[model samples]
Structure formats: C-alpha cells, structure tokens
Target: MATEQPRSSGSNTQRPLTSALAQHTQKKQWKDLSTPEKVVTATKTTTNYAVIATGAVLVAAIGYAIVSELFGSNSDTRIFGDALEKVRNNDQLQEIIGTPMMGHGEASSSKRRRNRRIHSQVVLDAEGKEHLLMRFYVEGPDNEGIAHLEMVKDQRNKWEYKYLFVDIPGGVRRAQRIFVEYNKDAGLPAIDDK
Candidate 1:
C-alpha cells in the first residue's frame, strides 16, 4: 500500500536523455552538410595563397635567368671586347698601312655615292700598332655607320687586324685583305679567312 515514493525532482536519467537529444540534433545538423560545399570553402581560402606564392617564385626565377644571361662570363661581348683590346696594342698596323688597298665590291660604289664623305682616324699604340676608327657620312642617312679596326702583332710577330664589330659590311674582310697585302710584301703567308 501505500503511494509510491514521489519521484525526485533531480533525476539523472531524465537529464542524460535530454542532453543526448541535444547532442543528436547538433550532430545531425553537422552531418547533413554537403561535401562539395565544405571542400570548396576550404580550397578557396588555401588556393589563393598557394597561387600567389607560385607566381612570385616564377617571376623571381625568370628575372634571375635574364640577369645571369646578360652578365655571364661567357657572354659574347665580353670575349670579343677583350680580343679587341689586345689587337689595339699591337705593332702590325704600321707595317700594313703602306701596302696597296683593294676596292670593296659593287656595294661599296653605291654606298660611296650615297655617303658623300668618308672620314677616318688612326690612333697609334705604344707598340706602334694602329687602331683605325672610320665613319661614313651619308647625305640622306640619319645616322653615320662607324667601323673600328685594330691591328696587333700575332704570335709570329706579324700584324693582324681584328674587327670590333663583326656585323659591319666588309669590316673583317677588309682588314684581312690589308693584312695579306702587307704581309705578302714581307714574304709572309696571307692571312687565312677563317
């Protein structure tokens, strides 16, 4: 008999059940999220930083390559310039100057007509070798074309001409012709055209 004991207001079973329902609700909401949405959100934040870093590295590499190429020891200008300096201080030009000169090809004729004046200067080194600097002035040409030729003593103590700018028309060839003619008078072999 009697009435059952009144249930206690503080009940562990009820509390646990309520907390469990709340946890279940939170877990279901979290689990229902789309996979693609999560992935895209995460990628969007990380990819931007990754792309910017990659671009910066690529730009730096390209810049370094260009600068290294320009200033490298094996650069064409460095080697050619050094060879030209040696030619300037040699003693071969004096011996070659007195010899007969050959005419440049048909092109020279037309160029000569266009260029009304041909101005040339010669500077001698301590060894008596001559460095020739010539400029051609054309009546209608906007800019003058200049040629620099340096004659130096080779290992055989003979004179040889080295051209400063190889791209110029007849620059190296003319120097070779002059060297050959002068060396021929001295009973030496003609300069090879290699």
Candidate 2:
C-alpha cells in the first residue's frame, strides 16, 4: 500500500501581483498625515520647487550668455547706436529704403514709434567686416510689428544697411527674447514691458 501525502494549506499560496500592490498601498498611513503635517509637506515641496526653478533659470542664463558670446556679439549697444545713427543720417539708402513698411502710411502713422531698441547679431560677410543682423521693435500698435536686417559698418564706421528683412514672425520674436535674456542688463523691448 502507498502512503498518502497531505496537501499544503491555500493560505501559503502566493498572492497575485495586483493584490500585493494593494496591500502595500493600504499599509501607508496616509490618514495619519495631519493638517499641519500636510501643510509642512506642501510647504517643503513648494520651496523645493521654487529653489529648483530659480537654479534652473540661473544656469540657463549663464548658458545663454556663453552661447551668445560664441555665436552672437557681447556688445549689442553699439549695434543699436549704429542703427539709430543710420536712421538719423538719412544718408544711407539701405537704412532708408530697405527699412520695412507695413503698408501705405495712415495719418496716425505719422506718430513715430517710440522705444525703438535693437537686438543685434554680428555676422561676417565675405568681406570679413563685422555686420549686424538687427531686430528692431516699436511701441506703437501691433501693426507696427518688428523689423530685422543686416547692417554693415563702412570704413568710416558708419553703418550701411544690407539687403535683409526678416518677415519671420515667431522666430524673430523668439530671437528678441533670447537676445534680451542673453544681455540681461540690456533694456527689454517696449513691447515686453507690457
């Protein structure tokens, strides 16, 4: 006769993954988190987030400056001044004629747009002279919009406009923001103040 072996109890059987996870979650003392405890946790989390965000912004600012130094110019004030000088002289055709106009000027358009500031990028042409890609903005209506062009400095140090008008909307706007951030102390375009 063969001896019969007893079966092990079902309690010893392994639980399903889902039931195990449920048990693990149920074990947490979520209700034990009192109002004050919750507040503290919330405050800590908020402060941590704020610190991280500020750090990230600082690092990004530093990175932007470095990249701008490499790909862009460190001194954009000179570019802005040059553009203004060209506009003032009226002797430069490129600055006068090449300057973009939205449409036939209305009577209200006689009001010259104020707060005209330039975001400049210095590029080298085949001639090896440092040329500026200037993005200028106005404080007038949205219709006033923005303008971008390349202006080169002649031997006399006078800026002569080049054949450049960037009609790109979003890209130019983004570039303006990046340039402003790159030059942190530089005044923002009047549009951004709003």
Candidate 3:
C-alpha cells in the first residue's frame, strides 16, 4: 500500500487510558502505604464504641438508683406500723371512735348504721419506715363517711396520720370528716384548722 491509512477519528486515544491506569496504581500504593495509618483508624472506631457503651451503662445505673430510692420499702413500713399501733392504743381514739368529726351527727350515725363494721389496719411504707399502709371496710352516707387512719411517728415522737378512705359511692366528704376526727382523737394538731 502506497499511502498510510488515515488514523480513525472515533478512537479512544492512549493518553486517557494511561492517565486512568496511573490513578489506579497510585490508589493501590496509598493502600499499601503504612500499618500505622490502619491502626489509627481502628483505634478511633474502637474508642467511639467504648464511649457510647459507657454512657449507656451510666444512664441505666442512675435510673435504677432513682426508682429504688423512691419506691423501695427498705425499712419505712415497720416504722409506720409501729407508729400506727401507738396511735391506735392512744386514749383519744377510744373516746372519738364512734363520733363524727364533721357534718350532722344524725347523718354520720346513719352511715355508721349502714356500715356496721368499719375497720382499719396499717402496713409499712415503701421505704420500710412505719408510715405505709392499706385500708378497707369503712362506713358512710352521701355526706358523712368513715375512713381508716395510719399513723407514723417522727424523731420528736409526734404522730402523723395518713388517711385512707374506704370506697363509698358518694361519700368522699364524709370520709374526710372521719380522717379529721381520727387526727383530733389521736391528739395530733390539725394543720388545716391552723
């Protein structure tokens, strides 16, 4: 052939391919560069994981401590029970056991009639102190009701009455009366009257 064939205009020239190959080779060299670099990367990842785990553990421990302190009976129940027993044995309770602290005497008397067996008892408070309790079986009418009281003693030997009203369909006010009477009878100062 006399004249050389004209170079194809649509061909991908060698220059672009060579440059791409050089870039890939450089990247490979970067990967093989150093062990220390890899160790630093791994250390960063591990440290982040450790920090997150520690934070989670601390949060859990704090939550548990709060719940236990607030709700745990530890020893308050026994103290509350002892204080209530003391109140029960007091002379004033005997005198006011059948009397109404508020409202008409006739209505209170009627309610007592309907609920012949008004009873109460004390359990320990959640903290294991003597101020916690459960109450059941009260007497009352629409406006005059009876409640059981649980008492606790402070360091000064003063009694604190915790009031629990028996389930009466429409006698909450009456239940309050009963609570007040219990306190008055127990010889504890009435905070409300003050």
Candidate 4:
C-alpha cells in the first residue's frame, strides 16, 4: 500500500474539534454594574446561597407560626399534660379526646421539640360573650392529632363547652382544615332551638 503524505498548512488543512474549541472561546466583559447588580455580581454564586438561606429561614418562621396558631403556641404554657388534666373533668372533652391514640406516645425529635404548648386563649364575641380557645397536638407514632376546643364562660365563671374538633394534620395543609371541619361536624351534636 502507498503511504499518504502530510498536508501542508493551507485552507484545505482542517483543524481538530479540540483545536476549534480552544480558538473560539470569547471572554466575558467585566463592567461596573448598578448597586444591586454589583451586589449580585460580586457574589454571583454566593448570592444564590445567601438568597436560599434567607428564603429557608423565612419559610421556617412561617411554618412555625401556622403550626403554633392551629396546634399550639410557645407563649401559651397551658398545654399537653396540664391541658389534658383540666379538660378531663368535662364529659364532652373526654369523649372527643379519648381515642386509641390518646395514650403515651413518642414523636419525631423535631416534632417533640417544636410543638410543646397547648394554645389557650379567651375572646369575646359580638354578643360580648367571653369564649375560651384551646388547641393542641396529640401526636402518636403513626398519628398526629390536632384538638381545637372552645368553651364559653358566663358572668358566674362557669364554662360551657362550645365546639370540639379532633383531627390529624396528615402533613398536608389542605387536608388539615378539611379534617377540622369534618371532625367538628361528626363529633358534635347540632344545637337545637328548643
């Protein structure tokens, strides 16, 4: 077989893919950006991390607030064992809260630490009637329970049970509210005008 000769450096000579790539790389321009842009440019990659961190913190706070409002709050010390003991005296309360999942149970370390309080408050309605608010979480291994109970008080300071609802958050926000309304209806008897 005849050996082929090497081509001379002319237009007919073709460059390899690697050499073409090495030749065509255009450098990006560095310019003075606006204050915001400068802050963003100086910390281009770092900014993503910073923004993500800030967003993460914000999300955590909002999550905490929503959980606190519905389940319980930190400022409200009336919760868990204490709330259970007090509510036990009422027949209506005992029936609603007493379930197979009512006994001693352990939850995840995160949940055990976060929702430690049972929310309790007093509010007046348009009729100037004072109402008591009680909300708490009773979490078991497979079950996470939310109890929202309201009791009204008269001038003589006697409490009248108003509404009772028990449900599980199921880790889904939409389902939690649905269960709240559903449990409240199923667990309580409708008031009669008689």
* Winning candidate number (TM-score): 4
Order candidates by lDDT, high to low: 4, 2, 3, 1
lDDT: worst 10-residue window of model 2: 177-186
Pick the winner on lDDT between candidates 1 and 2: 2
Angstrom error at residue 108, model 2: 26
lDDT (C-alpha) at residue 55 in model 4: 100
Q: Which candidate is the best by lDDT?
A: 4
lDDT of 2 by residue, 1-194 (tens): 99998676667776455776677766336578889878887899999999999999999999998776455533465555444443333323222234432322112443575433345567776857767676664222232334455656655555555543323234323322111112222222235445
Off by over 4 Å in 2: 1-75, 78-118, 163-194
Tens digit per residue, CA lDDT, model 3, 54-92: 999999999998876455543333333343444344344
Give candidate 2's TM-score. Answer: 0.27
Q: Which parts of model 4 have CA positions greater than 4 angstroms off?
A: 1-115, 170-194
Which candidate would rank higher by lDDT, 2 or 3? Answer: 2
Compute each candidate's TM-score over C-alphas: 0.30, 0.27, 0.28, 0.34
lDDT of each: 0.42, 0.49, 0.45, 0.53
Poorest 10 consecutive residues by lDDT, candidate 1: 136-145
Task: Find the number of clashing residue pairs for candidate 3.
Answer: 22
**TM-score of candidate 4 to 2 decimals:** 0.34
Q: Is candidate 2 or candidate 4 better by TM-score?
A: 4
Who is ahead in lDDT, 2 or 4?
A: 4
